[model samples]
Target: MSIPAALRRRTPRGTPATGRGLRLPVSACVVAAVLLAVVLVPLLVPLDEQAVDMTNKLHAPSLAHPFGTDDVGRDVLLRCVYGLRVSLLVGVVAALTATVIGTAVGAAAGAVGGRTDRMVMRAVDVFSSVPHLLLGIFIVAMFRPGVWPVVISVGLTHWLSTARIVRAELLSLRSRDFVDAAVSGGASRWRVGVRHLLPGVLPQAGLAAVLMVPHAIWHESALSFLGLGLPTHRASLGNMIQDARGTLLAGDWWPTLFPGLFLIVPTLAIASLAGVWRERINPRRRSELML
Candidate 1:
């Protein structure tokens, strides 16, 4: 229902505490935690994330190979298990880059006002007017193939919407009371902006970061699907899906199905996380936001 009551902070007298207003979505909690676990364990446990075993090809799901094997005999479970690392890594890096660039540009536009805001927003509008995939393709075409290329290209292309969002939020905050108080207290523009305004900006940025993960995941996969992404040796989700695309009609269901399913999990995770954020922000209105 409304931001689960179980998370409500209570005192011995059964009154709500200072933390009472904050809430977390249970589904997001499980999904985010599971994703983190999947990414970390393989790295720490010494299971070679990229070690290929030719003899194990095409084995169906069993005690040993849970998800099954691919056409080349690599353990599908191991690949999926490790593939989360690659996908999440790309998603995290690209999204952070986008957020940082967006935040800086947006902050300056909101803080300076007048010609600066107009110029920055006009630039954002120009970029946003173009198709994201088209820009991504051009970026990929410009660079030689690699993982960083995907990160940089996606990062650059995806920042406009976030920049606009940050700009709008900062605009709203610019005239607020504490902002005025900080200014009246003789705080420098940078200090007041960073200390007072930026703290308020974080919730949106956090939500943006989580929401951006799915976008990054889908973008990377689409790029690889279009043949403009990570090279074979890297073993990204995109490359996995690209490998599976050829086998889809050949009755090689494992290759296609497994990668697709893995991609869906994170998309679902982010959607759920976004929902939780909505609920936590507006407990009574969570259902409206959910749909």
Candidate 2:
């Protein structure tokens, strides 16, 4: 009379995250926790950026001042925590936008063959000819450097690579026997794309996105370094770097270094986990799963 737990998707035995699974593996859990900490510790800690202690200016890492104070005495730790939030925000937003646009374009190119495909791909080819970081700079240049501008700029520049991958996968997938069978079974083109093909290629798109995040974070920081970044109040890792540049000549590494390290950890974690995430997306992987 007691209800049993629902079986996992195609799981043969273990359920990795469900307590019945592999317990997330020690390394995976640690990495995931580290990524979570990058988002959390800064928010939980109560450090003020504007609270100035001129007496303690340029303090080195010590028992009291772990990350040390900046030239004006702002907590490097607080600024880094705040900067992580902003940098991660921009990266996630921009990547999602690109994913959406790329999915549409790539799916269309695959679904609609002949001249439409040729024209769309030609446009894709054009974007490919331009270097992404240079294009990111130019796009950010066109608009005033702010949160939305960075988000939109980076998102637009990123879709080229995604669109190409999507096209390749969709083209090959649309011709599969199952797809033709679905079409012959009276499914609409949209249905075929959405129900079958879209789901098939979406994992690859996600993988592309996860892989792209580190590069995106780096670019965001680089653009900020170049003064084409967010306002200082916004607290992106790049802005933090900008703030620290003046003090760097005198060797204030703590201010710039710690935020940068936090910025990097998520990018690397997500990138490294991309393969796992992609595999999770595959139906075949479900069959291969042990509980």
Candidate 3:
């Protein structure tokens, strides 16, 4: 039973072809759906932050209030939705800020080399020596407790790892045949770095960015929990849990439990997606996963 060449050429690599691209894994798909819901549902349903109903205070999960009410009687479910918004915003912004700083520093160090590289690497070492959380707390303490401070704190503290990754990647890429050809063809150092080296380094940097999101989220939560994140009146997962500390001993678990779950689930989902993306992007790992 010899197959015709045309049929063999048309056949898919790993599965029956239905003229569609490979589908995402079940876990990745589930995570993507959850993330989409978390980001979108809150926009569709508005809730009041200042509308306190003391009559419903400390209520447990029920049909009317699926996540129950907080001490001041704001709908816990709505607060959770709003909290998700703040967490996602902080995570996304912080990760982006870190990535930009890292990319610039790493690209410059790797491209310039010599004195620039040494100084940059030394700076990275100094930053890396400090514990990220402690550094974040100190930075927030120095400035006002708000969204930008937390974002800046997390961004400033977290870029060291990304810088190192990009620097290593660029160092390797700089010596490649194509880059050498571009240099030999009269392209300026800046052009070669931006056009060739930068693009080559972006994939690794992007993966680093994806991985940074969870860390940023956790950092934001930690800051918020310590009352140094968003304003106390603003809804945030960290502050929601902070509010529950006094009530936990009195058997009021829903207040803390729901927000904690909200925080953990999204972080896990994002991390899971990053893992899947990494596996898919790496040829060896993609092959292994397929097998």
Candidate 4:
């Protein structure tokens, strides 16, 4: 019999399994560093909003201001740290909101199948047909530009995929022998769903939530860039980039470049970690990739 690809060692059968070792650790380290920056930077380094030196404004990278100064002579490095904090907050909260909404809807639809399932799925399809970014823009447009509005926008627009994942997982769990046994033992639908089905799908749902963080961060950044997210006074990756357009055009690059790096690095690190989790959770999908 042919061994499954996912179970096979990366090298030959006799060799050490080395391919998976580096990625997970490196990604974890990067993510930890980002979280540390988000937590410690604000408390350790204070930024005085009113203290701007026009003579020192827009200085290129130097020993005094490592990441350089912005258009108003504020430290770019400090602002980038603040931006990461805001972006991380928005991403994590929005993802959790989406996960909760999706899990509830999906659990209901899967647990009470038949007409209810059909109706719920139809609703999902209708929502999914619209692009997430466009829908997010519309939702955010209804509220004042701020952190909460952006969070709500990203959460509402991003839950469709999670719902589908959860619904499918619950449906699969519903057909299992344990579920049928519970039903035969006079257990109520709600009891069986809560005790059995919910636990089975939690891992999948958790993975989906983890994967949503990067997308949520990017969404928040995009909205802020468009001036529909956090206000201009707030330190956000999108707001930073938006505020730096003139300087970038004027041939000074650090203002735009450093914030963009901060944004890109975390998203990539989170994505890598998510990939590792996906492979560990779903060996079949990983096997397919090895083919």
Give residue 123's lDDT in candidate 4 (0 to 100). 99
Name the candidate, 1 or 3, with the larger lDDT value: 3
Q: What lDDT would each prediction earn against the true structure?
A: 0.76, 0.77, 0.85, 0.89
> Model 2: what TM-score?
0.81
Arrange candidates by lDDT, descending: 4, 3, 2, 1
**Looking at model 2, how many pairs of residues clash?**
5
lDDT of 3 by residue, 1-291 (tens): 998875554332454544223333544675676567677776776768557999999999999899999999988888887888788888999999999999889988987899999998998998899888988889999987789999999999888888999999999888889988998899998899789988878888999998999889988988999999999889999999999999999999999999999888778767767765775677675565565
Measured against the true structure, the TM-scores of the candidates, in listed sequence, are: 0.80, 0.81, 0.85, 0.89
For 40-76, candidate 4 gives per-residue lDDT tens digits of 8767767653357788899999999999999888888
Best by TM-score: 4
lDDT of 3 at 249: 90
- The C-alpha local distance difference test score for the whole of candidate 3 amounts to 0.85
- Which pairs, if any, clash in model 2? 13-290, 13-291, 14-290, 14-291, 15-21
Cα lDDT of model 1 by residue, 175-287, tens digit: 78988998899999889878988887777877787788889988887887777887775567777877767666777687777778888876776766675574466434444
Worst 10 residues of 4 by lDDT: 8-17
Measured on C-alpha atoms, candidate 2 has an lDDT of 0.77
